[model samples]
Target: MGQVLFYKDLWKEEFWENPWELGGLIVIGLFTVTFLFFILFAVLFGLLFPSEQTENEE
Candidate 1:
């Protein structure tokens, strides 16, 4: 690993070594999970409450 960073090293960097680019995948995964949970809870609540009438409306 240290040889790659040396001035005389012939090899470049591996793909995973980039610092900034990796965070995008984590952020995207997090958002996707949140979105899926939002949809799931929306469905669950809609089924549980039926949305026909608010009981508190009376």
Candidate 2:
């Protein structure tokens, strides 16, 4: 039995030669950075201004 391969050579010149792949990679990178930035901002905001909950109200 032979094993199937699904991974491609990301560092290969051929990989970067495809405009579609390059564009997809750029989009993915931007999305990841934006997601991380939002998460960090939320965390900082929460830490800086935390909500106060009193036991008097449910």
Candidate 3:
């Protein structure tokens, strides 16, 4: 238990030492994943099937 607490405290100190760097990396990763998700879906839908054209009556 003592070892665990010591490790936890160390981790907290390290995390607080440079929060901005970690936060920025997390935010960038999230955005990259999100952008890739939308792009993949858009491409999949775009290539899946063609849209049908309706005939106009005069």
Candidate 4:
């Protein structure tokens, strides 16, 4: 029996030629996920805690 790999994985030599692209992709993906997490947290935090208003009496 034989196994098959994706086209991207099949091109091992070509893939290593510019490995930085893969690293960049990983970094970009990490940042994207982090950005999404921060956005979600920001929305949740804002909904959970609204700003308090200060009242001044003369």
Best by TM-score: 2
RMSD of 3: 6.8
- Against the true structure, candidate 4 has what lDDT? 0.82
Put down candidate 1 lDDT per residue, 1-58, tens digits, no spaces. 6765673343334334666656776889999999999999999998899856687886
> Against the unseen true structure, what C-alpha lDDT does each candidate score?
0.75, 0.85, 0.89, 0.82
Error of 4 at 9 (Å): 9.0
lDDT tens digits, residue span 1-58, model 3: 9999999999888886797978987999999999999999999998897566668633
Model 3, residue 24: displacement in angstroms? 0.6
Off by over 4 Å in 4: 1-13, 16-18, 56-58
Q: Give the C-alpha miss distance for residue 30 in model 2, angstroms.
A: 0.8
Local lDDT at 14 for model 3:
85
Ranking by TM-score: 2, 1, 4, 3
* lDDT over C-alpha atoms for residue 50 of model 3: 59
**Clashing residue pair totals per candidate (backbone < 3 A):** 0, 0, 0, 0
Worst 10 residues of 2 by lDDT: 1-10
